[model samples]
Target: MSSRRLVVMRHAKAEQDGPTDFERPLASRGRRDAEAAGAWLASQGVAPDHALVSAALRTQQTWESVASGAGWTLSPDFDRGLYAAGPESALDIVRLVPDSASVLVVIGHNPTMAVLAQLLDDGSADAEVGASMAGDFPTSAVAVFSYDGAWADLGEGTARLEAFHVGRA
Candidate 1:
């Protein structure tokens, strides 16, 4: 099985007031933080070949800023399911990714993102990283994992947490 890298990120801070939750836009701080997140991922040598992003306005803007900051030129699939997804639903979406993608990025909302990160972890990776993730998975936070199996086989305790970061700018 090929070693695959999964970069899971929570969308950056969004304005509290909007026409609807799905229509909310990223705040200025969110844009800056997301850019920083992208830069950080790039410094860590994470280059995603495929990206799954929520179709929400905030998520779309976050992805755009992240891609710009990372100097990556690619389009991501704006998945509507991710907008209302829980941890399990998000995992199901990931399972659909083709084996050809060695590195994948998923950007979406929290709770789901945090829970998914926790669920995927096998507790065999860096203790500090795991602990940090457990404490708080705030906006702009990212969890990177490495899995040595097919995407279809990804489940609870199937991945090793490699890194965790929260972008603030």
Candidate 2:
């Protein structure tokens, strides 16, 4: 049984000061929430073997804050594809992860993150969690799924939604 863990999250709230969307930074509340998200993951004893993050400023800042708060040493792979990518692109990215990584995290924009999480969730027995995740994904919200397949084989209906975490607002 080659079980794997996938964590998909939308970047925390970001500053509106940037001239362009890609240049926007995390807002004050975003920083705090990012740390809390890390703390919650740590409390659950969840540590990612690798992180695939978006290249945007806010996304990078979110991961940095989370790693610092969780006391985790994570080497992330930042790709532009995740910036405003759709669910299929997101799934393709997950499939590209090495098989050695048992746990992987992806931090990026919304809509896509939300769609990817919901697509993988399938009909997970936990109806409530599944419904909420598929409904809406807020800033700093994480959807954790367990997959019983290889990364290259990742796709819709192949994973179970184990839990969803939302940092303090």
For TM-score, the strongest prediction is 1
**Candidate 2 local accuracy as lDDT?**
0.87
Tell me each candidate's TM-score. Answer: 0.98, 0.95
RMSD of each: 0.7, 1.3
Q: Clash number for every model?
A: 0, 0
lDDT of each: 0.95, 0.87
TM-score of candidate 1 to 2 decimals = 0.98
The 10-residue segment of model 2 with minimum total lDDT is: 122-131
Collision pairs in model 2: none
Badly placed stretches (over 4 Å) of model 1 are: none
**CA shift of 27, model 2, Å:** 0.1
lDDT of 2 by residue, 38-127 (tens): 888788677999999999999999999889778989889998999978999988988899889998989999889988887887685488
Highest lDDT, which number?
A: 1
What lDDT is reached at residue 66 by model 2?
86
Residue pairs in collision within model 1: none
